[model samples]
Target chain A: MTFFEAENVSKNYAGHTALDHVSINVKEQSIFGLLGPNGAGKTTLIRIINQIIGPDTGELRIKGEKLNPDHIAQIGYLPEERGLYKKMKVGEQAMYLARLKGLSKQDAYSRLKKWFEKFEIENWWGKKVEELSKGMAQKVQFIVTVVHEPSLLIFDEPFSGFDPINAELLKQEILKLKDKGATIIFSTHNMSSVEELCDNIALIDKAKVILDGEMQSIKQEYKSNAYELKVRDLQKDINEILPSSFNLKKIRALNNCQSFVVELPGNVTSNELLSQVMPHAQVSSFEEILPTMNEIFIRKVTEAGRSK
Target chain B: MNKIFTILRREYLSRVKKKSFIIMTVLGPILMAALFVVPVYLANVSDREMKVAVLDETGLFYDAFHNSDKVEYENIYMDYATARDQFEELDYDALLHIPESALNNPNSVKLLSTSNIGLNMISDMESVIQKKLEAHRLSLSGIDKKVLEDIEVDVTINTFIYKEGEEKQNYSEISYALGLISGLLIYIFIFLYGAQVMRGVIEEKTSRIVEVIVSSVKPFQLMMGKIVGIALVGLTQFVLWVILTGLIVFTFQTINPDLFKYKSPEQQMIENKGLTPDELAVQQENLELSNDKANSLLEGIRQIQFGNILIMFLFYFIGGYLLYASLFAAIGSAVDNETDTQQFMLPVTIPLILAIISMQVVLNNPDGPVAFWMSIIPFTSPIIMMARIPFNPPVAYWEIGLSLAMLVAGFVFTTWLAARIYRTGILMYGKKASFRELFKWIRF
Candidate 1:
């Protein structure tokens, strides 16, 4: 089910379009990635979802209800530019933000305590935000964003300032949140994290979505007919054994095996290529090579740029 | 409403808990009390004694100079060079050199001092010489100096203000002081509290906390909460200052009862010393005169309608602060930093500064056209009306009512515009917003 949706949303700032006819749906209890280069309207769309800015023309619905101020309580937003009152104590600032997100004072305190303990930052409660390291402050902000347990959580570049260890911790926490039936809208340029965590994605470029679908299906849709085969046969004439539809791109010899990259013509299946290569050499392993999300992102953005 | 309260609570608590706020709150009343009491206390504390050597070449005035606690006079007959030498050797504060020609031209009488002599000392010396000269001239003309001295007259004017059906006493001096004070207080409170609202906005924007808070609460709610919260802070500080200053003043008054007395300390000292019957009678008459002055001052204070003034004061105080604070908040929202605020701040502050500048005119002629128009205009009424209130100006009820209504309308309009600018500006980064951009945000 669609947990949140922005339909044909358009936003203009002083005659400049920030979001132009942009549309995306985030599924329930899943990690939805909002992928875009800088100024690709990703932040604008996220802000629209948070209702920080209203769309000039569009409909925004949360859980099948028209978006209103009432929905603010159900949405958690950690903006791209992370901010906390530097003079405020970490625990107090977190609790204040949690209360602002509609948590009772007692509830905010208890939840924040649990999160602080979970993150092993129980001692930082009394420390001011400015006294904390940037990564520690980011941890505090992350806790503040989720302490209220909003059903739909939006994180814009959530891992930008985190060390690798904390990034792993945050990734685990995000998955934990999704496991607890929370729908997450994760926006970032970090493709590795997207590939590791996101179930669906919408790649926006220049105020428009150029590619969007289930992460697996989008990767599948972008795959060229290519295969990586490991065969222990330098003795065989590999080119003569290969079918006319298969083009051998590169062959490398390992210590015990020869690795070959083969591209098949359209309408040709990997199984047929594997069968054609099986007779002349000992086929030890065979695997399909799909493009990485990074490559796909670059290609899609460049293609959209060219078309523009 | 609950969200607004939440924001207000945070704004208030965070600020009230600040070290700077606490320091200012504690120091403000002490400073105000000092401003009122210190000058009076210092005036009552007598200055150090000064010794003067008078070279009287005209021996006729030798006995005219007498000794007092603050000044001692010694008659010395010597040449100018010898007197100057003796003056330095004796460490005298000054030498009063009366040349032989001084009997013809009094201006030739020169006073030489090692340092800058007090004006009071110079004036006293002049008066003594003038009195003795006058006596000498009168005697030479064969007239009795005592008779001329005794022929003294005192004139007092009893003013009664005639109103609709009754006549009441009027004290212009006391009323003028009250008007000036109340008007000045309003001006100070507005500037103090309005700047607080602006600073609060800039702090939130610069710290980048506005975006996070506004995501949960409307920008309008945030701005209103901040303005009202800082207003409460201002009112709290003002009340504390009033109470503290009153206590300090009362303590000082109790400790030195003569500090605020009408008579100078020298006169009070003379009355305390042994005196002949004639001198005693003169002291008694002076005391009676001071008693009458004190009574009249008390009566003037009693005639003021403090209850009405208090009510109107609070009304205008809040109305004026709200009107100006909204504009200040708008200026704050339209700028990226305090430096950028100057361009917008000038326009908002001009009217308030104008109100203060025009306060004297309002006080001098509370019923004149300038005062009437200034008190009726919403921008200037808060100060001018308070000033005119003490004068019992014939301001119609409808004029005050309309002025207040217009102030309320102005507040609403400015707050709406401020909210529009604030919502757009808080999230905006890097760009220095100009007037044109602010107008566009209002349209947005």
Candidate 2:
């Protein structure tokens, strides 16, 4: 059974629909990426799940039970709008927030110590939050959100303000938490991060989910008739030998070496094209390259825009 | 384990550690006491010395305005033009010219000074003129001046009470004083602490911390936690301040006993003016009677069944603070920002101000409908009732019980309203919300 499921959720904020009959399932121990561009109801959906705002009509089931107060204790949420007591000390503020999440003082302190040490921020305990750098404060915020070790974690742009090294470090911790059987819901526009970490992906656009499935399957579903082929330039121009049935999408050449994304007829295979083109140039490498997540994201959003 | 208690502890500790809280708490009472006492202390020592040139054309007030340390009169015959010419050079503070036959026309006399003269100086001259004029009347009458001085009235203040048995005196003066102090303190603490709650909410809301905390705890818990925390902070500071102020005042009095001395010869003369041995004796007898009456009135109040007004003061103080603090929190949360807060602040603040204004009236006449209603109103009662409790309250125990219950009920209801608004307002960004939207949010 799914750890969390929302069935036919709908919400309207002052007659403007933010979520229109949205539904999704989050399996336990899975990294489910809620992907969308700016203003795409991704945050609206996340807020509904966290119960920060109520859905107009829906049933939000957590661990096969209706979502309520007790479910909040098992879920940790890091809001996109980062907030902390600017005047309070780092550890003091963290402890207060941790307690609010239902962690006892002893348990919170013990967990904070480990998280702080692991994040190499143990020395930051005495520093006031306002005195810390943005990245440093983000680390503290990250610690507070996860200190209680909730079973379900929702992070909205959690890697924002984090440098690449720190972002990678956070990614490892998130994956480790998943390995320990925590269901994680991550929302971001960074398709690379989603591609690196997510097992399942849901793309939301204009208050509706346009696509939702396993990450690999969704990527396959959104593929275009494109491939990347790298070749040695034996013949000066490889395009001269290509049949009129083939469509050359793009080509790049440097230092007597060339690479291209080719669109072939549906009846033709890569071997047939390679056999025909081999005599024109000594092929260095030939393989079908799938589109990057960034390309797929832009394509799908543009497609949705055109459809509307 | 106890969530509310946990919130309270955190708030208490955090606020107590702040430097602003520490400074204000410890020094606030001393500063307040100084504001009251310093002026009184200064009034006694501040200059009674004002140099004056008296032109006594009538020759009647030469000795009327006798030389004293407070007013040193120097005789001068300079005309108006000459007095003006040497006004600054003559080293005179003021020139008092009583025109001829001024008693027949008191308005004809004029004072010339480089700047505005003190009212006391002008009033002193009038008083001396009136006494001399009255003395002239006595001389024309059959009685001599000495005989006229001996004629005095001895009035006694008596008290009659309708208690369980006999007619007992009431210590109305001390009771009024005690009542005023308790009531005023409650008024001040409620205002100070309630405003502190307002500022605390604004601070959190401005800092955006409310948004994050609201997601975890219910908005009601967050608002209650802040209200209770700030009250504890106020209470903690109040205790520290009481101790510190007492110590500072005790030290000042002990180390500088001369500062309090009012035994100077001028002070003695001022105390003993216009009285003979017989008149003095009569005055003393009347004073003793009034003092006895005052003391007995005090004893009557002390003997009444209420255990201690101080305890009631504390209960009503906490109750009043909680009641007002919640209202302040509600107002604080209603607006997303401070500027918008003003639109709602008036209605929230007027009740507190009214409670203070009505507190004395309640003390003077506790059994009156005004006091009874103010005490039971829940808004004014915390202060009004506390003030009147020192005075004899003619009411059943149920009134007190009912007032307390209503205060609790009022707090619970208002807290829910504040929490509902807070939950919606905290996360709302950018757009401004109206009263209609906020009221609608409560329905959700």
Candidate 3:
């Protein structure tokens, strides 16, 4: 069974529909990515899943039962807006947050100390939260959110303030957490991180998912039949001898060699473009160009916008 | 329940442990005492050498406005114009310009000073003029001043209060003390705990911690936990204040032996029973008339019963706090920010202010129609009942019972209303809502 499923979930803020007829399944122990641009309702969907808010329409099921208050104990959410009480000490604040997530005082303290020690922030325990750096405070928030060992963890822009080394450190910790049987929903605009971390992605735009599949499969589905061919070009327009299905997009000539990009139309294969391009110019080498996840994200979103 | 306890412990410890809280708690009484003492000290300090010129045009007040010790009177002023000029030039602290007609009319007195008038100068003028007028009237009636003085005008009436089921009683001192203690307790707790609820709501809402905490617990639980915890904290502080005050006074009483006056000259052989020499000297200097009144007040106090008043004060104090704190919590949740709280705050504060203003009326007329009805009303009962407790009360038991019931009923009803608002309001944002909108949300 899926760990959680949101069926036909809909939410509206005033007259503006934040999410419309959206449905998705999060499987157990998988790192699922929610990829979307700004104002794409990712945070709204995350809030509904966390039960921080209720959907205006539709139902959410946790494990095999309908969602209830007890299910909140199983979900650990880190929202984009980080907040810590400025007047409280870091350690006391962490313990207070942990107890809210269902840990006893002693348990919360022990678990929080372990996390703090792991993050090498033991010396910060006695300091007020306002005294800490942004990254340090975020680390405290991260520890509190995870201290109860929740089954599902949702992080919204979790790596925003960290330097590269600390980002890598947090990345390793995420992987370690997943290995310990936790389902992760990591939402971010950083495509490189998505490429490294996410196994499944649902790209949302305009309050709806425009693309949903495995990361690799979705990337493959959006690839264009374009090729880069290095050739020794004898000057030619290269549009002639090709059917309307094939067109040359770019041509770059070096001292003795040339490189060119080819495009194909409907039902046209990369082989057809390669075969047609070879006759027009002396092709040195040819290869098909698959789109990057960043390109796919941008293209899908822009296409979604244009369609709207 | 355990979650509530955890929340309470966290609230009580962390809040009370703050540097601000500790300093305020420890220094609050000291500051209040300083507030009482500093004015008297400053008055004594700045009044060491007051120089005034007196111009008595009708010769009616030449020596009437006598000056001695710290006050020096110069009789050189001849007219109002000259006095006004010297006053504006800061020649003296003030000029006493008693117009010729003012001494005969008695109500035509006015002080022309450069800067401003003060209470001491007004009282001094009234006392000296009234004494001279009395002496002049006596002399005109062909009576000698010494004969009139020996004739004694003081009236001493013995007031005996007896009840069918109780003994003869004197209630003047007990009533005054009861009103003072009760009014202060109600005033202090309402402010202390009401602000606690406001600060707690603001803290959780501002830190965005309310979002996560609300996921696991209902908004009502969070609100109640904060209110109860802070109530307990207030109670703790009060208990500590009481204990600390008692300890400080005890230390002063047991160690110094110079502070308090004792009534019995016959109990000196009983050792710890009588005043020391300095305390006796101070008591002797307090004058015979005031000492007789003090003895009767002490007798009256011993005749009165305090047991009912203590119970009534506890009930009304807690009940009143719970009622007002609920409203504060509701207001805190409704507006999303403190700036908007003022609009709702005025309604809650009005009743408290009215009750305080009517305290004297309640004390003077406990069984009067106004005090009776106000005491039965829940909002005014906390202070009204306290102020009435000392006046041999004549308070009916049914009134106390009915007031308690109404307060309890009011508390429950308000808690439900506040819970409904808190559940919705804590999550609402952006738009400034109308009362209609807030009421509609309660229904939602």
Candidate 4:
């Protein structure tokens, strides 16, 4: 079931359109990546979903019901510019934010205690946020965003200030949240993480969604039907042996091994290309090259830009 | 509603728990009480007796210089040079030289002292010499000095204010002081607490916590919560100040009751006397003629309606603060930092500053056109009305009712405007907002 959806949502600020007739749907218990460049309407769309802003012309639904203030309790948002009261104690600030999200005081305290312990940060609860390092404060803010166990969690650029280890830890935590049946909308410029974590993604560019689908299918749709072949025989000429249906893109020699990249025509399958190249050389390895999410993001955004 | 409470609780608790807030709350009343009591204590404690030597070469004013509680005068029989040399030996604070120019050119009288002589001593000596010279000239002109003294007449006016079919004595001095104080207190409370609200908003905005809070609660709720929370802090401080100031003033008064005593010596003497009815009546009349000045001042203080002033003072204080603080909050949200707030602050503070500047005019003519218009206008009425209320002016009930209604309306309008500016401005950064931009936010 679609846990959250925005139908033809548009937002205008001053004379500029921030979001122009954008629609997105997130499946239950899945991580939906919102990919966009700087100045795109990704943040605006996320804000609309959180109801921090109202769309100029559209409606939002949560759990197949019309959105209202009551839905705020079920949504948690961590904005791109992360913030916390610098002079406030960590535990108290967390509890206050959780209560603001509609959790009981006792429940907030108990849940925060567990989260703090799980993160091994129980000792820092009494410290002021200003005294904490940027990464530490980000962790505290991350804890605050999910402490209430909202059904839909929106994190904008959640991994920007984190180190590699902390980013891995956060990735684990996000996966754990998804396992616990929370629908997540993650927005970032980092595409590698989207490949690792996102089940589905919608690429927004220039206030419009240019590409969106399940992560596997979007990468598959952008693939060039290319394959990397490692052959031991350096004596065979790859250009002459390849059929007219296939184009040999490159042939490189590494030590005693020769590897060639071959692209198949649209009508040709990967198996056909593999079989066609097998007799030309001693094919030790044959692997189809699928495009990375990063390649797909860059290619699609540039293509959209060029088209416009 | 619950989210607003959460924000309110956070704002109040974080501020009230600050060490600075506690220190100010405790220190404010002590400083205020000291302002009232210290000057009185200093005046009483610094009264030391001074001694003067009078070298009268003319010998015409030997007995004119009399001793009082604050000064002692002794006549010296010596030349000017001998008197000057003996002045230090005599330990005199000053030496008064009455040069003989055939008792003419009174302005040429010289007073020499080792150090600066007190103005009180100089005036006293001048008056003594003038009185004796006047009597001397009167006798030489063939007119009896007693006839000139008998022609002297003292005039006094007793003021009564007739209101609601009753005669109420009016005390302009006491009421003026109370009016000035009430008006000044409201001015101070509004400025002090309004800036506090502005500073609180700036802190939250600059810290970037506003977006976090606004996401959970509406921007309007967050602004209202902060405004109300700081107002409660102001009220808490004020209540503490009133109680502490009262306690301090009461303790000081109880410890030094004589410090505030306004009784004249003649009244004290009459109370101690026992006389026949005929003598008593004559003495009583003389006492009234001699000491009515002191009694009239005390009576004037007794005639003021303190209870009425207190009630109106509190009402205007809260109303004025609410009206100004909302505007201050709006200015705070429109800026990136404190320095950027100057342009917005001037417009918001001008009306309050104008109210204070016109307080004196309102106090003088509580029923005049300026006072009437100022007291009727919502922006100025908080202070001007408090000033006028103490004077027992013939202000109609509906004027006050209308003024209060307008003040509430003003607060509501400003709060609505502030919320609009705050919602958009909180998320904006690194831009100096113009009035045009602020108005745009209001439209948005």
Off by over 4 Å in 1: A231-260, A275-284, B48-59, B62-69, B72-101, B105-119, B135-160, B173-178, B264-302, B305-310
lDDT of each: 0.85, 0.78, 0.76, 0.84
Which candidate achieves the best lDDT against the true structure? 1
List, residue by residue over A122-229, the lDDT tens digit for candidate 1: 999999988999899889888888888889999999999999999999999999999999999999999999999999999998888888999999888898888999
Write the residue-wise lDDT of candidate 4 on B340-389 in tens digits. Answer: 88889888878878989988888888888998888878888998998888
**What DockQ results for candidate 4?**
0.67
TM-score of the second chain for every model? 0.83, 0.72, 0.69, 0.87
Best by the TM-score measure: 4
Candidate 3: tens digits of C-alpha lDDT, residues B1-444: 666776777878877887877887777656554554455445444454677777777676765554544566776546777567666565776677667777468777666556665577678678877877778778888888667655756676765567777656455657777676778678778877897798678667666677667766667778888888887777767666655665655655566453354434323322322345754454454456666766887787776666666667667878888888887887777776778788878878888888888887777677888787777787777778777766764577788788788889878887888887777677655445667766876785
The lDDT-based order of candidates, best leading, equals 1, 4, 2, 3
**TM agreement with the true structure for every prediction:** 0.88, 0.79, 0.76, 0.91
How large is the interface RMSD of candidate 3? 2.2
| CA error at residue B182 for candidate 1, angstroms | 3.7
Off by over 4 Å in 4: A236-253, A275-280, B46-48, B86-94, B105-117, B142-144, B153-156, B263-291
Q: What would the per-residue lDDT of candidate 4 be over residues A82-104, giving only the tens digit for each residue?
A: 67888999989999989988999
Q: Give me candidate 2's TM-score against the actual structure.
A: 0.79
Task: Write down the TM-score for model 3.
Answer: 0.76
- What are the per-model C-alpha RMSD values against the true structure? 3.8, 5.7, 8.2, 3.7
Q: What is the lDDT of residue B345 in candidate 2?
A: 79
Give the CAPRI class of candidate 4: medium
- lDDT string for model 2 (A80-188, tens) is 8776788889999898889888888899999999999999989999989888998898888888888888899999998999999999988998999999999999999
